[model samples]
Target: GVSRIKEFDKGFQEAVKLAFNTVGIQNAKPSNEIANTTPKTVETIKQQEIKQEIPSNTYTSNGVKYQVATTGNNSFLLINQDNNKVVANFYPSSLPNVYHVEVISDKGHYETIGYSKDNSIIIETKTGDKSWVTTTYTK
Candidate 1:
């Protein structure tokens, strides 16, 4: 009976290996090896996540430069490159590639609308006299 049990166990082990091989999962690592490499794998994944979270490129318009960066939570910041200050906060609009921008100024807060396409961003703002002025920034 013991011999029969041993034979059954051997067959089960071979069956498991064959099933793994059929599914193209050969050379399965032992638990010890997997544990040893897990930290490195986690570190690599963390690095990739950090890269994905980083902000995108800088764009320029009218000799003034601007950088668009993510502020998390689906929000963004528009930074003025000349003074390195955050000039505006950008929130995503319902339309694709469009954002509602709030310009920060010493005078007061003003709202604008902007759209981005390819390497350019176009913003339309209302002047004090209620005239619309459009500015384009390019990468």
Candidate 2:
């Protein structure tokens, strides 16, 4: 049961960080990786392959505490528990095809390339180099 919770947490947090790190407007199509894997994962979840409802866990990294929760349908909401405000939301739309993300922060705003094998979120800009940021929230 704990392992199941961890995996779902893994999926949710990575998706959130993927949205958070994306800075700047970018037009992105889901990579072959997402197209190949996400649909099955989402479908499996829909079929109850994995448990969906899990309690939010808190982790402190560099003095920042995060509350990550899985709402539904592979969607997650992250909040700054210390501040009691929303941090970012990561939601998957139309799996097995193109999944796009939008993250807005004081730093910048960008879109998602979905999640990667290494669990890092890559955000791309419309007409520029690709920048990557690794976010750790622990499963």
- Choose the strongest candidate by TM-score: 1
| Winning candidate number (lDDT) | 1
* Local accuracy of candidate 2 as per-residue lDDT tens digits, 1-139: 1123357768777767666666557798779976676577667667754322332567454577768666776666666778776555666544432224555667776666433222223233354455555454432
| Root-mean-square deviation per candidate | 14.6, 26.5
In candidate 1, what are the lDDT values of residues 13-122, reduced to their tens digit? 77777767778846865698666665776676656432122236898877888888788755688788888888778776655567788888778888888777667777
User: TM per model?
Assistant: 0.54, 0.41
Name model 1 segments beyond 4 Å from true: 1-55
Cα displacement (Å) at residue 138, model 2 = 2.5
Q: How many backbone collisions does model 2 have?
A: 4
**lDDT (C-alpha, whole model) for all candidates:** 0.73, 0.54
